[model samples]
Target chain A: MKTFEYRTAAGLAAGLEPGAVFLAGGTNLVDLMKLGVATPDVLVDVNRLPLHEVSGLPDGGIRIGSAVRNSDLAADHRVRTAYPVLSQALLAGASGQLRNMATTGGNLLQRTRCRYFMDATMPCNKHRPGSGCPARDGDHRNLAILGGSPACVATHPSDMAVALAAVDAVVQVDGPAGQRSIPVTGLYRLPEDTPERDTVLEHGELITAVDLPALPVAARSTYRKARDRASYAFAAGSVAAALRVADGLVADVRLAFGAVAPKPWRAYVAEEALRGQPATEERFRAAADAELAAARPLRDNAYKIALIRNLTAAVLTALAEDVR
Target chain B: MRLTVNGAQHHLVGLDPRTTLLDALREHLHLTGAKKGCDHGQCGACTVLLDGRRVNSCLILAITQQDAEVTTVEGLGRRGEPHPVQQGFLDHDGFQCGYCTPGQICSAIGMLDEAGKGWPSAVTEDDDLLSDREIRERMSGNLCRCGAYPAMVPAIRQAAGR
Candidate 1:
C-alpha cells in the first residue's frame, strides 16, 4: 500500500493540501480503499478539527457541523423534535457501530455502495471513465431507476441525504475560493456526461456544515424505507416526506426518495402536483405516477418505479391519517 | 502514526496508511483478542472502543487516528476475572467456535452505553427499554455466524444485569 502524507485541518479556514482527502469517520472511505476503489495519496485527519456542533440557526433552523456523528445527530433534541424525518432516516441507516462512527458530512459525501462500483475488475463507468457500465444490462436489481443515464445507474446509498433533500437543506463548503453554500438538491449531479464525478464539489473543497431551514411542515414528517430485510441492509426503496393537510386539502408538502436515483431524488414534480389538491390516495398516486413517469428503469430495477410510487403513497397515507 | 491502545503508547513508524486499526492492534501491538472475520465492516468482528465509542476497527486507518485512545477486547478483562459481558457469555453460552465472542462482548458494552445515554434504536420507538428485540436491533452490528443469537440475547441481557 502506498501510504500518503498525513495532515490535520488547522481550523475552519485551514490550508488545503494538494493530493489530499479529508478523513472524518472512515466508514465509507476506508471500505472503498480496502476494495481498491479509492486510493488517496493524502489522508488528512479532520476528526479533531473542532467542527463538531449541532447548533440552531437564527432562522429557527438547524446548523449541523460536518463532523457531527450520525448517532449524535439522531439523538439531538432539536432534530428529533423538529425534523423527525431526519432522525428516522439516520437511525434507519447502517448499524449501531457504523452510525456511531459516520459523520454528517461523511454521510452526505458517501459514495454509492454499489457492488459493481466497488469491484475494480468490473466494467463500471463510474469506476473507470468511458468504460462500459456492465450493470446497465447486468444484475442491477438495486440500481437507479430515475435520473439515470446510459453511462451509469448506481444509487446514492445515504438515507440521511434523502431526508436533507426533502427539507430546504443547504450544504456549506470551504474551499480555496473561500466559503460558499450549495443547496443539497444542487449538490449532487446526475451522471449524464460525467459519471466519474459523484458530486459537484471541487478537488480541495471541504464540506463544513449543513443548514436546514425552518420548516414547521417537517413536524409531521416520516421516513419509510423498504429493503430485503429489517436491519443492516440498504434501501430497496425509501421515502422521506412532510405532509400538511387542511380540511382534506394538501396545504404543503416536501418529498424525496432514496435508492431510486443518482442523487437523493427529490420529488418536486410530485410536490407541485399535490399542492392545493385533496389529501387522498388518488391524489397521492397521481402525484407519484407523474413523478415516476419520467423514470427510465433498467431491466432488473423496473420494479423500483412501482415500489417508489407505493412507498410515496404509503408515507402520505400515514401522514394524512395524522391529520384526522 | 501514534496510537495509545489499551493504555500503552505505540509509535508505528513507516506503517502503510492503508493499515487498519485492527491490524495495528493485532499485528503491531500483538493484541489478538479482537478478531477479523469480514475485515470489510460487514461482520463487525473488528469492533473496538475508539474514544469510548464502539467502531469497526477495520474500517479505520491507523494513521487517521493519531490522537485516539483505542480499547480492544484485551483491555476489557482477564480470563478468570472476566468482564461482565465476558462472564455473561461464559455463563449463558453465547458462543460456539468462540470467534465472534470478543466483538459481541465489546458491542454489548457499547450498546449499554448508548441505551443509557438516551440514544434510541430503529426498533426503539418511544422508550429505551432493553427488550429482547431492542437488544437484537442494537447488537445487530456484531454478527455471530454460528446462529448464536438465541443464546446471545440472554447473555447480553445478563451482562446488562437484567
Candidate 2:
C-alpha cells in the first residue's frame, strides 16, 4: 500500500482537494488500498464530521447521515418499523463485524467484486481503461446480466443499495461544484465505456445523507437475497419489494434487483406491469419476465434469470399475502 | 497517533497512514492476540472491539481510530479469570486447531452485546431466542477451517444463556 498523509476533516469542504479521498469505515477502501486498487495521496477522515445521525426529516421522511454505520442503521427502530426492507437488506449484507464498520455512503460506493477488477495483474477495463474485460469470457457466472456494456459486465455487490433503490431514496452530496440531490435510481451508471467510474459523483464530491421519502406501503416491504452461503456472502440474485394490494389488485408496488446488473436496478418495468394488475402468481411471473426481457445474459450466467424470477415471485407472493 | 486499547493509552510517533489497527496492535504494541488470517477482511481472525462494537482490525487504519476505544482478545480476560464467552469455549472445546479461537471469542463477546441490545441478525424472526442457527449465521464471518462450528455454536449459546 502506498503511504499517505492522514488528517481529520475539520469541516465538510476541507477534504475536497485533488488526490484526496474521504475515509469513513474503511472496510472497502482499505481492502482496495491493500490490493493497490486505490492509491490516494491524502486520507481525509470523515468520521469526525457531523454526518453521523439518522434523523427524521420535516417532510415525513428519514435522512440517514452518510457516516452512520450499517449496523446502527439496521438496528434503528424507525428504519425497522417504517422501512423493514432497508433493515433486512442491511442485515442480509456483510457480517456483524463488517456492518459495524461499514457506513451508509461507503456501502453505496462499494466497488464491483469482479475478480479481474480486484486483481491488478488481470486485464480489466474497470481497473485500467482500454485494457479489456476478462470477465466477459472468463469466470462470468457472477457477472452482470443487465445494464452491461461491452467493456464491462460486473454486478454491483450491495444489498443496501438495492433496498434504497426500491424505496426511491435520494442522496444529498457536497462537492467542489456544489451540493446536489441525486435520486438513488440515478446514482449509478451503466458499465459503459468508462467502467472505472462507478457513480456519477465527481472526484471531490462527498455524500452528506440519504433521504428516504415516507411511503406507507414501505412498512410492508422485505428484502430477500440468494447466495452460495446462507450468510456472509454477496448475493447471487436478490429482490427488494414493497407491495400494497387492495381488493386483490396491486395498489402500489416497488421492486428492485441486486447482483444482476451494473447497479441497483429499480424494476420500473415490473412496477409498471404490476400496478392495478391482479395480485396473482401468473401476473407476478409475467411482470418479472417483462423486466427481465431486456436482460442480455452471458453464457455462464443464464441461470440468474430463472433464479431471479423465482425470487421475485416468492417475495411478491409473500407481500401480497401479508396485505390480504 | 495515540491509540487507547483496553483502557490503556499508547502514544506512538511516525506511523504510516497505511498501517491498519491490527498491524498497530500486533507490531507496534506487540499485542499479538488478534491473529491476521486474511488481511483483506475476508476472515474474522483480526476481529476486535472498536467503541464496544466488533470490527475487523485489518480493515481499519490505525490513524482513523484515534478517538475510538479498541479491545483485543487479550483484554477480554486473563488466564485465572476467563470471560464467560471464553469459559464457554473452553467448556465446549470450541476449537481443534485454536487458530480462529481468539477471533471467535472476541466476536462472541461482541455478538452477545449486540443481541442483548435487541439487534436482529438476518435469520432473526422477531424473537430473542438466540438459536443455534442464529449463532451460526451471526458468526459466519469467522470461518473455522477445522470445522469447529458444531462445538462453537453450543459454546456461544451457553454464553448467551440460551
Listed models, DockQ each: 0.76, 0.91
CAPRI grade of model 2:
high
**Residue A59, model 2, lDDT:** 82
Model 1: per-residue Cα lDDT over A1-324, one tens digit each: 455677777676664666678889989988887788887887777888767999989989999999999999999989988999999999999988899899999999989877889898887888889878888878889999888888988899999999999997999999777999999999998999688999998887889999999999998898999999878999999999999999999999999999999899999999999999999998999999999999887878989988888999999999999998
Candidate 1 segments whose C-alpha is farther than 4 A from its true place: A15-18
The TM-score measured for candidate 1 stands at: 0.97
B1-162, model 2: which lDDT tens digit per residue? 899998999998988878899999999999999999989889899999999999999999988888899999999887799998998999999999999899999999999899889998899985853888888888988988999999999999988887
Error in Å for residue A171 of model 2: 0.2
* Candidate of highest TM-score: 2
| Off by more than 4 A, model 2 | none
Give the B-chain TM-score of model 2: 0.97
